[model samples]
Target chain A: MKAEFAHYKKEELMRMLTIMQTIRTFEEKAGMMYGLRKIGGFCHLYTGQEAVAAGAISSLDLSKDYVVTAYRDHGHALACGMDPKKAMAELFGKVTGCSHGKGGSMHLFDVEHHFFGGNGIVGAQIPVAAGVAFAQQYQGSDGVTLCFFGDGAFHQGAVHETFNLGKIWDLPIVFIIENNQWGMGTNWKKVSAVDDFSVTAGAYGMKGSSCNGLDVLDVRATIEKAVAEARLGRPSLVEARTYRYKGHSMSDPQKYRTREEIDEYRKRDAIQSFRSRLSEEKILSEEEWSALTQRINTQIEEAVAFAEESPEPALSELYTDIYA
Target chain B: MAEMTYREALNRALDEEMARDDRVFLIGEEVGEYDGAYKVSRGLLSKYGPKRVRDTPISELGFTGLGVGAAIAGLRPVVEWMTHNFALLALDQVVNNAAKLRQMSGGQLSVPIVFRGPNGPAEFLAAQHSQALGSYWMHVPGLKVVAPATPADAYGLLKSAIRNDNPVVMLEAELMYAWKGEVSEQEFLVPIGKARIAREGVDVTLITYSKPIRVVEEAADRLAEKGVQAEVIDLRSLRPLDEETIVNSVRKTGRCVVVDEAWPLASPGATIAHLVDSRCFDVLDAPVELVSGEDVPMPYNHTLELAAQPSVEKVIAAVAKVLYREDV
Candidate 1:
């Protein structure tokens, strides 16, 4: 891990930081758009969990590798190089959106970039992710897939089925659990019997590990190693211990956790900590840091403007894409 | 052309398609070394080897999603459910993910997969094991449902289903597997959403599909003996439903009877009866008659089960009602 971290030059590290900031800014704006009634229908923002997507995606080769995740997907989508305007336009239900506006917030997809989707159903993506890996194995590609889900998805029967399928087939995949502390309003502790995933790893007969998802460096290092092993036909399960700053969705009252707890997690905010760490290491100047922040803010603003100007899908589009 | 049973026709289709395209593969429980639950995939294991002829664990929800994923990733997967009774367990993957992926992804992904298995009643496999669940698949817009009656259709539709870009649910009948028919060795496709008139007549239209098509044909034959010509319309494709053929036949006959081996309420037969009542009402000489499986769970006793399901007598009785024949 030290060797891997040492090899990441200032240029590479800056790019990861840029992606994390872009996701944070993009999702914050999406939240605001939802509030203003510009977006509708079950919007789940990826506000605080940017590092897991950023670091994990940065470690994969998007040209061949694949990614799939649950509904909190704007972060994963942006990190996979999706144009923010297209993602925002999708949320706005515009024709220019990536899914042509039919699939709003929870169903984002870009097969060209190999981002499988924003699957809304909890734990459903696991078997689909395994299948994507099956195709990779069937086609004899060295591609490894990264599948993301929340702590809530652990209770689904589908995930358990996927665990068995993936292990038996020895498909090249990484099952990532983004332990963002809560599944909707319920705490993972109450619903889940086994919090430590090493036990799950043993039960499923797959290699497993955990990482500090708050640190982008750790996320990348852990995922990168797992991916390398996956390419050799050794599948794995990696849990990224993280948090979500926003409520589950804009509609959630979030009475389950305290503001103090959110503030406590915010102290270890992935973006702020990485920004400060880069400055102290003489990798990023304060002027450059503020300039990057200003630039990303402007980008998010433009994305919103794009959504505002984009056309709503025509009446005929409703009939199209229902088949083929 | 060759004489083959329904199961052999299905096996031949799989063998030929897998030979034609490298993307086509068979994956289901007992599809490999165990042959197949119904012997439909008997020799495919030796033909395509383990990579293509895969036997999955009894994880319908898991493997079905995997098949959808594989299809989305540009592989054609023929996933046999052994029996659609077990497919109930995997409905979430089929309804939520496979059927909706293309539309929800806004056409970026196409799930080119086939979920084929025996449906409806057979032997004494009552209640849960013998449901004609094709209506559920047809109820969804994104799916194309194919219910083949003959070996020729079993061969052709299965081949075409493998090539279709959208998801296809093939409703096969357990009792029909041993029914022999002439199938052409030279490949052909019985295009989805088309109906073939099994027996053309002008007196009355008998609309039916899979399993019950045989009984309907027998009823038509008996009607022919009685000097009353009856049209037997075999609806091979259930979803895009051969409405043109159905309406056209009803118009010609001026009377129609729908025979479906499924529960009556909102069933395919009722749907066809409504279509006839709506599309050919002006041309109709009599009210539409529906001969559907009794609105009850399938009973275990053979006699009770026959009473519960569609039979030749029920089809004839419905035909009689449509004809206004009071045994004069």
Candidate 2:
């Protein structure tokens, strides 16, 4: 981790903190709404691992670089520039949603912001990301594709196939694994033979590095290097040892792990850690932190109101975009 | 008109399209130096080099999904799936990704990609290789599924597929690859979702596509000799089926017989029969008859394979059955 991130800046650190704070606020509101039975269906929140999306995307040019992630994708979308209101409205199943309410929490797509989607199938985005990178390369554009998945999806065969292809073709693509300890009810160790996912990249002749996802600065710097390498036509991998604060979805009771285990990760929560670091470095005073918190709370409130006032899509729209 | 084999016409279409637009390129297994599995991409590697006419490893899902991504990212990638059988390996990428990306992205991204390959049963390629999954894709909403019956349609439809701003599945017939036909020398485009009447008549309407189209034509010729005027409609595009044409024909003839090289239950035959019955049943004098392949996997024996697929004899029998009471 030290060697991977030797160059770090304060503004970048502040930016990472801001992203994590926004995600934390948005996720907490979403979880509260889910508990109140206001938001229906599947709801996966990115709580313990805010830095993975925030840090990785910070190194990318949102106007050009493409971002694709697994179902646990709210954080990635927010980090890439999707308004919290539109994202929340989407989760609320409102027509004003990012995908016009067609996709919920599991499938968030905002192409205008260069956020491809929040794919549900395991390791499905690996090849899609490579394709995007291939297009960039074929068209002589210096763009890159950053693909993220979970440790559970890492076991999928398509992941390895894409890794090899991305390396061989030297396509500008990055594979990011958010190893959040558990896959639904099962742990990562039981599902995977080799626990070290970074080693998986060596077979494809690409550099693979590991980072502490709880540390926002470390994640930002590491992903910056990975994106740079990919931009040079050399694909790379970054295994972020993070934790999801909520269950796999709103449905899961999280019976596989102990409350104590959850508490242990919560002690090093990414959002809390960043807040503390910012205060310690005098970047933000306690009074300023409170004001920022108040501002984000207002934003969340307006997003919910905007969604509640929005109308549902008409029945005829069901078959509108079957093709372009 | 210029005479050429279906394979040559298809190759010419790709070469011409790629030369016409820098955004258009070919990628798939054995497409570059290997000259494609069927030599359809032969001599393309030397002209375009490895970057444009890329030869991919045996990773259909990877490359196909990459093609979808490339298309969505703004490049026209014509992906070759060695055969329709191999497409099963990449179903998730094609069905879930390529087909749904545009809608899912709120029309922000368009997968201008073509998943093309020789489809349907071919000789003794066995059960795995000979399965016809064209109807399976036609069942999908966002995908434009096109199966050309003649060399002219093959060339024109391919050019349209390349230029379409959506994902298209170009299912060619393996048996019809070497078949010779006359195609226009000038470039042309056949609009998708439109069906053409290969032979116009008044006794009955025969709906078919791909290899079974030939069988339907033969049956039409036989019926013409017997005073039965049968109109044969070769449905070039399956998904956006020209239902108006089939309904109008069935309404006029007062009878219909659907021919397909697939099994009877819920296949293309069933789809057409149901559509006609639901929309134009009152106009029909007799129940719509369907001539379909036997409900069994294609066998290695040439005779057994012929028996398993819908044949000219079977189509003739069905047409005769439909027109039995029409004439003395």
Candidate 3:
């Protein structure tokens, strides 16, 4: 862990911790808001899957690189530097939200951040990500696209189709599968033919690998190499074996899993483990940890307040975005 | 003006748009290298190179979604399906993503993409291959559906679709691809949502578009022989419906017969019939009649296939009924 931090500057490592903590806090608040019926529509909390986004997104150049992900995307958007206020407001379905309240929770877009969107349709964003990469290559840009999807999206026909095109065209895109073990309520193993999702990447003529999604360092290091390869007009797939601490959505009863299984994954919580690792390396002191926590709490509170105070979209807005 | 085939007009539109906009590119199955599945995109690969004229795998969902993304990212993509039948596989991306992206993104993104291909029955092409999908697309809100009947409209409308800011679905008539008509060499554009009065008269109105326009014209010719001057209104754009032109024609003629190649139920003809009934009710002397394809899966047998779709005789009969000429 110390060796992983050795390559990164103290400030950069602190930023990573800040991003991960922010994502965790933000998701927790969003879950609470959904429970209060403040955030309508689908609310997919990315509480336990913070490392996958924090690790991978931190490696790319946000100015030029693009990102598109599935519905469980609050963590990814925050990781891509979307303002928590705007994201929370979006979940609240306010005019100030990133998508101007037209897209409730499943679709959050910030073109300024080069974050394409958070598509609600399962596996729909896969080929779109490939197109983004294709555009990068067409324009002769070195920019890469990071396409994120859940393990469930691996079964979609578009995934294989995109994989083939991405590899054949050598498009600058890294296909990231955040294998959070479960697709909605059903475990992925029951639905997917292959136990290993990365292995399927080989059939598409691309290199495949997996990373410990629990370790932010592992995700960052593994994705850094993949992003580098993609920048050189090569496409690759990296599966991050992670888990979601909550149900698939706000409405999910989560009857598929037991408490003990949840407990097991929580014991190796990405944020907690990373904090402990930093403490052992003397990179963060107890006082510094408390201060970071305080800062993150304030940010989350401010974001919630902003969302609460934001206005609902006007009726005229219904027709504005229907066309260009 | 030059006399060119409908295929040449479409090809010219693709060529001109590709030349006019650096961001515009073509992609689909056999669009490149193979010229086109129907040779509609002939010589484009050589003129624009492989980068602009892309040959895709038989992955309709893949490339269609890719085109949607590229459109959102500021590139105008022209994605040609081998035929509209094959486009059904990619309908999810087209209807859900491309159509809804702009509104879903709150106008942060606009999918300026054109999906063009031959649609409707072509000779003996059977059920799977033969389908008139204009009404299917017109049912979707965020889509602009265009079915050009002639070479000029094909050239003009295809150019407009590529330049439009929204997602446009251009459904071409497969049988009419080789039909030659005069098209202007000078740059021109036919605005969407506006219908053209192909042949004007006052006895009865023949409202139709795409391949069925020919049927209506033939019906008009025969109606002329019987001393009935029928007005012909070609509805180039389906979704917008061009209700004003349709209503005005119905007002003048006091009768209408909508001829569509699509099936009868929930078809574009039904939509027009409903519109004419509601808006032009006072002006109409008789109820609007719709001559649509039979409500059955297109048969493989040539005779059944011909019977399944609208014919010249059917349109003439429908017109005769609307005009109360029972002895025709």
Q: Looking at candidate 3, what TM-score does chain B attain?
A: 0.99
Better of 1 and 2 by TM-score: 1
lDDT of 2 at B77: 94
For residues B14-51, what per-residue lDDT tens digits would candidate 1 score against the true structure? 99899999999999999999999989999889889999
Between candidates 1 and 3, name the one with more favorable DockQ.
1
- Model 2, span A1-324: residue lDDT tens: 233223556566667777888888999999998888768888889988898898889889977899988888899999998998889888887777887777788888888899998887888888998988998898888889999999999988789889989988999988999999888889999989887899878888999999998887788778888888988999999999999878999899888999999999999988887777676666668897788788888998888788778888778778776677
Per-model DockQ: 0.84, 0.75, 0.82
Per-prediction fnat values?
0.74, 0.67, 0.75
* Model 1 alpha-carbon miss at residue B229, Å: 0.8
Evaluate all candidate structures by whole-model CA lDDT and list the values in order.
0.91, 0.86, 0.91
Question: Given the true complex, what DockQ would model 1 score?
Answer: 0.84
lDDT of 2 at B142: 86
Give the clashing pairs for model 2: A322-B142
For model 3, the stretches where C-alpha displacement exceeds 4 angstroms are none
User: What is the lDDT, from 0 to 100, of the residue B205 in candidate 1?
Assistant: 91
Task: Select the stronger candidate by lDDT from 1 and 3.
Answer: 3
Q: Write the per-residue lDDT of candidate 2 for residues B144-254, one digit (tens) a residue.
A: 999998889989999999999989999997888988999999889888989999999998999998888878887788778888888999999997899988888888898
Looking at candidate 1, what is the lDDT of residue B242? Answer: 86
